[model samples]
Target: MGRMGDATRTVPCDAVAVSSIIETTGLVMEFPSTRALDGLDLRVSPGVTGLVGANGAGKTTLISLALGLLKPTSGGISVLGLDPSADGPQLRAMIGYGPERNVFPDDMVAYDYVRHFAQIRGLPRDEARSRASDSLYLVGLGEERFRALGTMSTGQRQRVKLAQAIAADPRLIVLDEPTDGLDPVQRDEMLAIIVDVNRKFGIDVMLSSHVLEEVERICDNVIALDAGRLVAQGSLDELAGALGGVDVEIVEVADRRDSIDLVAQRLVAGGWTVARRDPGLTVTGENDEEVFDAVVRAVADSGARIGRLGRRRRTLDDVFTNERGDSSDRPSTARTGGTE
Candidate 1:
């Protein structure tokens, strides 16, 4: 559930023996007037990684380039240390992909779809079918493995895609929005399966999603993208620690919303800036002792009973939005790009 990447080690060349699951440098992508990826750099270790970003934040582009589905206009790219452009077949064969986009044959059964990819990855017909069944079982879709793709629920179909990706026993698996369209229970189940695959089966994973909570809950490492560029890359703690400010939540008694203004006055008089406090709750600028004392005194004086007070940690969204806002504030002409 924490970040898993470390940049201290160098990438090896032979994929068959490659220790680094994925690596890219100065990776770039173009789309008419827009650049989808700019001088991006990325590295992934042998565990679950969260590729966190928005839909158009070059997340798809990064995956495509990394998977050898799209060629980079410039810079180096490799998955399992194999050049995706020149060694696509081998690279793909070593890696499994569950695309974010829906591009399935609606008429086919889940089993058939998975079996086809497994066979393509060079398994014999019987072996492919067997592995296909096994993969579907792993994703919790065993009962619907032979169900027509169009008839299954979105969650079921999502698992079908996952099964196909993992059917070949590849060393690495990439899941794009694996939890999309799933209920919380379904999401938890799917995540458990993914964790089992990574921890129990020893397969590395690269997961892409815009959901910060989901990523924060499951990923071992994170590579965050924003506005078609790398904004930050590291563990959750590292990024959260980079914050100069802190988050604090203050709670009060019932029907005491108007007490907020008085509370604010007390906090200000005590030298603390209250970020927000409408009624029963307040967010302070920081979580230091000075801020805490001021908030406590303010709540006590407001005559509103205190329910709870706690320090709030910085979330992934906060870090990314701040950096992206700064980037957007800069003059366009002054911008320089890079990739990950």
Candidate 2:
């Protein structure tokens, strides 16, 4: 009876506090041939969190579990203080999920489809209609809201999905590849809309995207998954600190071509590793202060003056690509478009 209640209850015994919107403990998911997730533990705070991973890295699997669309083979998941598997319907009511695929019904009008979703989420017919119209306009589809879905371009259809997702006024919006298949301008517009959704409405967002640049630009924190395991999770600064201790950039040498070797030798002599760049050299150290001191010492010893010297920050690409694992599925998500 106790076990039955555990399986049936909508709320987790250890409820999520204000600090975290989502938490998973020792999460595991196994298929017949492959383990989609392995002992994954994750915590998500408010604001925009980016879910990043190479294809087939179990990013989609994690998303599915969070939505309670797939029961985990082992582990527990809590969203908004509710057990996803046990209280899936209740949990999903507060979560707006936009899938990567284009599964919209072609014949229906955009506004009607969004309104239909709002109603399905338990809104009254009148309120759903009102919210749907407002959401479509908010997503920049107001002028075309009455148009048939089939008549819209890929970018427009993507906005329709966003409109429907927000129609119910959910607390958390989970967007998978929201910018996929969009042109540069469309992508920028979509990213802006995503930012506005969180800031303007006070909704938490989990963006699952392959574009590292966009994620870096919009996300407050990032979770990196690889081969069914969580390899990294933190604010961008924390992840960068863990991966790259400190990178000192030396620029504007008297003669870059000839000074590169001299600078590298000087830094190496100072017990620091140095990598050459076209316009500068990147020196590694234990921390910023230590790196700066070393850079000063190295420059003094080498008698080389630099126009600019500063600590360089690492990018998402640097963090993702430098991770050590069997990333055979790097392109798997690209091929599947994370549809599953």
Candidate 3:
């Protein structure tokens, strides 16, 4: 993982190499019946970081706590170098929030709606109007800025929410399920806009979503939560490494189960971990040679004709699935860290 000199450091595991833009230590949030967050400790870097988990994974509650909209039962959090609990206004001014729900007023014009929030957040009237217009354009809503929000499509409304979140030019924008209700095409568009918001505008983003593909596409780092505990946190590469080292998959020819079995047996004898999966066998080793040599020797010895053999990088979906198994085990309330 690449390291930046900023306060935000990339965390592969428990050891902190540098400070983070957002840091939480022993953060806990308790509801009447269950805990929304339990001794949660997380560190986030400045780039786009995807917060991913199953439904009710405390993703929303975590964002709310970071925004200072909800108070944690205990622990500390720092966002943009300031404590969210202590310096709420100051910290919030630097952080824009887009909730999962559509909170926009149907009657208001898009540009006016965005400008009003900017003004409320301390921007002068004229400045708010200017920034709102600019942000709307940035989010590809320039043509629809004058239109009523209620008349727009779901994708358009989502864009409007994003525009308003960035209207005040906050240092960090927290997006909760930004692609929640869009179709595939609209989802792609929204993700593109998110990429531009971070890359072109040089703004930082914390995107929380259950769509693993979206996160995989746009985020440089990911923080996965399960049962209010950090399932994993690090750059995408780091997380992949943590879950499992590099992986290689080999598929045998049609109706060649015996070939794969022999390959697995050979690999295991070579002191390499191998997993039997549908259509193929997954082999893992310390290096490419170790994995490749085993596969080669096994295939040659067993006379197993290969259909496809190559290294495959694990996706966020794989990591999430492997880390948190069985959707039935995930709770609806913070009890199982599924929802909060």
Candidate 4:
């Protein structure tokens, strides 16, 4: 069954969290075959914010536009109180970026790369060298600081990119797919570094990823997208709770989901809709004794075997799929407004 009552009563899973940093309006970017980004709008705050989407969904495009690397055909994007289109260099100087792809001077040692960045930031030669070493250590590069970057592994190369970005001590860091190629241990190490970058250095980070679970674990808030459009944006709990509530359906069937059509009809009588039929059907809304009893009577009357029946807690992934998937046949559960 879909839900017991109106899919409007939201269950509070946790407290709320909010922060505001980057903001956009009527954001649009176009290309030859497809509109890379539509009339998109987003609000990104400080702390560790997760920017998530599938490939070609405009996650990369949005970051490029926001950082001044690319301009929107029409729309406004701002970072750290500056417009990237006009003050690209100035804004970038105050913001650091680590791209999804690895780019570095293969011939240069890690020390030289970071030292060069520190020098470009106007530090004296000696201080630049010191800062470079400090950055190397911060990312767990010890004696390998003098090793040529081209000779390094993918993980090591990424660390170099991070080191150079921080050498300038920018207040804001934008990481595009930061954990792209690392294994479990390496990924965890990188995650730890990212957290330390925010907590210890007091820098605000905007990280983009397709790894939904990673985003949930590390982010304070999320701006999720699908096919280049913003579908849902907020703290994890807030977004998931908006799905209202979730419940598992128990049907009497040697095959639990076989006779859902009959049960669906009975559920419709009680103002419930059948959301899905899998291990069991998923119904929306709450703990309704009446609905449970109704389901029992229907199943017993139909001579269906009584299988497992329970409620499943909604998760961030569930909320993401439900919101970003097709909406033509579905009803929205109320939401706050966003910029055009």
Cα lDDT computed for each candidate against the true fold: 0.75, 0.79, 0.78, 0.73
lDDT of 2 at 258: 52
Top candidate, metric lDDT? 2
Give me the runs in candidate 4 sitting further than 4 Å from their true place.
Answer: 1-19, 241-313, 326-340
- Give lDDT: candidate 3, residue 198: 87
**Candidate 4: tens digits of C-alpha lDDT, residues 144-168:** 9999988998888878888887777
lDDT of 3 by residue, 1-340 (tens): 2222334333212221334668899999999987888898889997899998877778998999899889889998877777777878667767778888989788899999999999866677899999999999988888889999889887888899899998887778899988877877778888999988889877789998876767777898899888788888999777653433324345555666678788778888888888877767777777866677678788878777766667756766566667777555432211211111
Q: What lDDT tens digits, residue by residue, belong to model 1 across residues 53-166?
A: 766888888888888778898989888878988878667767888986666888999999999999877677899999999999889888888889988887787788889888
Q: Ten consecutive residues with minimal summed lDDT in candidate 2?
A: 331-340
Collision count for each candidate, in order: 13, 1, 4, 7
74 Cα displacement, candidate 2 (Å): 0.7
Candidate 1 has a TM-score of 0.79
Q: Once model 3 is optimally superposed onto the true structure by TM-score, how far is the C-alpha of residue 19 displaced, in angstroms?
A: 4.8
**Candidate 3 residue pairs in clash (backbone atoms < 3 Å):** 56-338, 56-339, 57-338, 227-337
TM-score of each: 0.79, 0.78, 0.78, 0.71
RMSD of each: 8.8, 6.2, 8.5, 13.2
